[model samples]
Target: MTVGLVVVSHSAQLAAGVVELASQMAHDVALVAAGGMDDGSVGTSLDRIMAALDEADSGDGVVVLADLGSAVMTAEAAIEFLDRPAAACLADAPLVEGSVAAAVEAQGGADQAAVLHAAETAWSPAGSASPPGPSGPKAGGGAPAPLTSVFTLVNPLGLHARPAAALASELGALDVEIDVNGVDAQSVMMLMTLGAGQGAELHVSASGPEAQQALDVVRRAVESGFGES
Candidate 1:
């Protein structure tokens, strides 16, 4: 089962717009927009957030990304009102970036924890070191090199949201630890952090049972220009 996402904002247009943008790369993922009050004014509403949480969940769980302080507070209230609070949680992340990242992760079949982690890390400083290795370094030496390859981004926009989401959604489901230029391949935010404009070479590597497949997926997406001309 795949996790879902809810975008909450004071402006109904903003929330819906975010959902629309995120859905471009994650068409199969469930995303709900809860914004504005019943009268369509700029304000948060517990009822709307609760309704979004319900519509967004597909049994696996749901991750809520809210804009501004009141939006977050409203989301929290909605989560608390749920009979099963653990089934949903609020992510403290920037609205657009977090929603897009979370949507991609959810589309990739990540669980609640992984989806939340994706949103939380959306704002991490660019070029930060890779996340901790799955296991500590081996006593004898460093871990074995993963299946690796290099591909230059040919699209003028480089690795923008759509391409990043496409790569992350396709790769995140694989049973592999893949990194593109030292950032997690399954993370849309990390991929965007590269700011890899045209001709920027992406160092793709993977380690796990599906390493080859994961690497191929990224290679193919990059070669295809991620559907861009």
Candidate 2:
């Protein structure tokens, strides 16, 4: 019976992606985010997240999860500034892991400890993520493929809603393992948060029975400027 959860990350897309994934698997953990903004403003993310926290009525006190160290400080300051009634605890894992842990714990009536383990479990075999290669996983795999293809925010809009929506729609149908750099590229806000534009690149790769097909699909979308067509 803990309170709701806040997932803090340097990238909003990553944070959002984790929440989305968590919602499907674990339903108890509510998520808010303190994510990056395009203006290079970090504080605003916290403000936005706290606002979300305000709406939740879970009396058990909230736990705050952070991706990196800075996320910790920011989360602390955010809780302090609001004087929120929920007891905010910071977990040192990426948003995906923290969100998973928080969700499981919140629903199971456990502490944040369980949440941390979920993170560790979430990222494995590939050292938790797709570094320069792909950020997701490999299905029907013999071995992980060589890293190939990347998506940069070279466009002025940095993969905004329209582009992201297009990208999602195009990529969604494919049987591919898509991993977004810095959190989750699968998320629109997270993509928005990348603050990538007019030259930023995001790594995308697929390795599995359908890796080639997935790669082609993503490649076309990226070259098409996030499927602006």
Which candidate number maximizes TM-score?
1
lDDT of 2 at 113: 49
Error at 111, model 1, angstroms: 1.7
lDDT of 1 by residue, 144-204 (tens): 6678899998878889877887777788678788888887777788888788988999998
Worst 10 residues of 2 by lDDT: 121-130
Candidate 1: how many backbone clashes?
0
Q: Residue by residue across 23-46, what tens digits does model 2's lDDT show?
A: 653455566655666465543365
TM-score for candidate 2, please give it.
0.43
Q: How many backbone clashes does candidate 2 have?
A: 18
- TM-scores, all models, native as reference: 0.85, 0.43
